[model samples]
Target: MSMAGDGREPLPHGPDPEVNHSSIGSTSPERDPLTSLMEIRGSLMVFATVMASVTYRAGLNPPGGFWTDNIDGHKAGTPVFQDVYCTRYKIFHYFNTSSFMMSLFILLFAIKASINNSDITKIMLHLTVLMDVITLIVSYIVGAYEDFQSSTYALVLMLMVFIYLVLEATTLIVRLCKAIRQMAYVLAKI
Candidate 1:
């Protein structure tokens, strides 16, 4: 694509920014992937925190499981909301909780990678992908234990998480490739 009006040759870094000023500051020549990744990580962190809380909390106090614990015990009667069968199924609460914790640690590494642009970022990226795979397995295991409806929901949510991690990995790879190509061009020019 022609980048300039005259079409002589596009600058290695693309067109000059006549006057650039934004909240993110000027886009560095490197086109650092971290800048965008930071925003995604921030949003994901908040979401994962809430999801984790709900995952563990819902296991203990599900909306469907709402019931008043009768201090009077069986002497009184079965509570109005107590379902003997509903409470039988146990959700794999730990999986989601652990997934949440892992996500946070990954976020920390993501932030570090974003800011520092070091080799450690690659390790963290691979870990993030691995965690996603583990979470998917956990969801299937939970499905084996949970009720049909709940199991479906859990699988769907885990699928979403898996897709998100994969997309992030792909984005980082593409951005890194672009940056490397630009750098190679610059080095050749020098």
Candidate 2:
């Protein structure tokens, strides 16, 4: 007959017929966000592993292959592409190595995040993933295309992706700022 201890008065009819008590505090296993995110992290780790392998292979066996013999002052082990297209090869290697390093960093942070679930690890995972994507795109653009026309197409694609990513990041930042401002306003009112 008394009111609920920490809440509103008891329902007039003893209990609300519409209330679903079983679902109030229990979360469904299938729809849990942490589980979903963990699955996604696993997939990301696999992707990063593949990317690392690919970049490493690309570094070893470039598009133009390698010098077979020590001839014309070119070492047998040196990349032929590096000799033929010095500038392009330098740019390609730089981006490729960057992508490889980023992939490793992403894998490391993702694993750490999976284990610890700390905010710093989460932030690092996001940042490394972002940088890895960017560097991978750049490496492909610089290394994959054989001609100017193909490179042009890749450049256009890169530009579109870059713009979309920038817009998404800007929107996220704006929303975060708005949420902080709203929270401050609410606290001030209190």
Candidate 3:
């Protein structure tokens, strides 16, 4: 017999003999990337929905007597609601809402990309969502509290929100730049 065929050497065996173990438990299901992405997207969507509703209610109905005169007989010129800056406030509020909606869309897109195993896109989407959250919080604080200009406490809160907005936006921009670089690298590799 030829050594290459019928004369081949037998396979080596371990010290212990193998035994059937079908009764043993199997491993748990692996973590699905889509599941994690969907969870994050769902959380972001819920937050956006709540913020949108609150913004709409505040814009449309407002509160009873939002422009009422003080008991000290000082008619504050129709309050902050009637001030010229009210237009600016409304514009900013609209921007905040639009940004949040856009971020939600980006998050959905990112989820799809993540399902396809794209990391850069997912990071960019997360950064976008974070930016939207920061903007929403700042705008909501500014829009909800008209006493920011009068009350020291409110003014401090406003300042803090403003600072947060700036910081978050800066960080998001940096992340976006990094993501773009990563995408370029991935594309070049392909």
Q: Pick the candidate with the highest TM-score.
A: 2
lDDT of 3 by residue, 1-190 (tens): 3356686776656543464344234322454545556656656666656655655565554322244566565364444443536665665556566655765565456445445434555566656666666666666665566564566677687678768767876776787688789879989999
Per-residue lDDT of candidate 2, residues 126-190 (tens digit): 55666677777777776777687757866897889977766765665666566667778989999
Off by over 4 Å in 1: 1-29, 32-36, 62-94, 106-115, 122-126, 129-137, 140-190
Better of 2 and 3 by lDDT: 2
lDDT of 1 by residue, 1-190 (tens): 4556875774457544873444346556555666655656666556545545545564455333444454544323332223433333333344555565666665565445436444345545555646644663564454344456756776687678777777777776776677677778989999
Shift in Å, residue 189, candidate 3:
4.0
lDDT of each: 0.54, 0.74, 0.59
Compared with the true structure, model 1 gives a TM-score of 0.39
Estimated TM-score per prediction? 0.39, 0.64, 0.54
- The per-candidate count of clashes, in order, stands at 0, 0, 0
Number of the candidate with higher TM-score, 1 or 2 = 2
- Model 2 CA lDDT for position 54: 89
Greater-TM-score candidate between 1 and 3: 3
